[model samples]
Target: MPAARTRRARAARKRQRRMAGVEHDLSADEWAGLQEAWGGCAYCGASGAALQKDCVLPISRGGRYTVLNVVPACASCNASKCNDEVTGWLRRKRLDERAFLTRLAEVHAGL
Candidate 1:
């Protein structure tokens, strides 16, 4: 039980540090817009699956939960992508890396 408690405390502290000084947090409206704009999982194009907020740059690597960095992903893709850089992960998954990048850039430009 003491070990479990220590793990939990460490996890909480890590979350706090990750969130510290996080400006430009995504708002409800921005999230809705993202969903509409992507129309599916941003990585897998899995429409109608429950979406999770995924950071293109992992929070552990200094990414913030901001509009520009966040994308909607299916649970499968989100879990698979944990803490990995987006382009490399996409390549490993055999996904269309260039298409994703171009679409992301177009979306960012419109914002």
Candidate 2:
């Protein structure tokens, strides 16, 4: 069973590497920017929860996983956004960048 689990894990890692190439990991600056961008849940504005690194621009659309192109988002938001551009995802949720950023800031500041 343990060997099977290890094999599955290795297979998953290989698949991810093949799919993402060298863009699977985020850079240091990009990570910091994500923390700043998505201080909490984009939906209910919750904070201190686990965050997922999300692409402001989808990699499929030629987006780099760089600082300016990444944002920290709650798991729910990340799942909801899927592979769409961040702007479009926000719009679909009836949110504007300004509002979203403001809320993110507020969540960060805990104000």
Candidate 3:
């Protein structure tokens, strides 16, 4: 048997979690934002991948629970990001952060 550390625990847990559907914890707008993502990862576009809830502006950095701050990210992206701010992480990954930039601008502008 494989050691516990070598086993795919997150995947196993994900399978178990699917039956319950992870959206129960989200607000109506958050669910809308998640559904708008079309089940693929919002960042890397990995289809049907196991996803995690991510805050575009991290709570630790003084972000809020507003729907605009939430996005569905694949487990790999989410774990790699940890508490880092969203736009900076995207920049470090060499991806265009324009959409987020516009959104952040709109948010700060009270849109």
Best by TM-score: 1
Regions more than 4 Å wrong, model 1: 1-9
In what order do the candidates fall by TM-score, top score first?
1, 2, 3
- TM for every model, in the order presented, reads 0.86, 0.59, 0.58
What lDDT would candidate 1 get against the real structure? 0.92
- Quote the lDDT for 6 in model 3: 54
Which candidate comes out best when scored by lDDT? 1
Query: Residue 1's C-alpha lDDT in candidate 2?
Result: 100
Estimate, for each residue in 1-111, the C-alpha lDDT of model 1 and write its tens digit: 999999999998987877785665799999999988999999989998899999999888889888999999999999999999999999999999999999999888888
Which pairs of residues have clashing backbones in candidate 2?
Answer: 30-67
Question: How many clashes would you count in candidate 1?
Answer: 0
- lDDT for model 3: 0.64
Model 3 TM-score (2 dp): 0.58
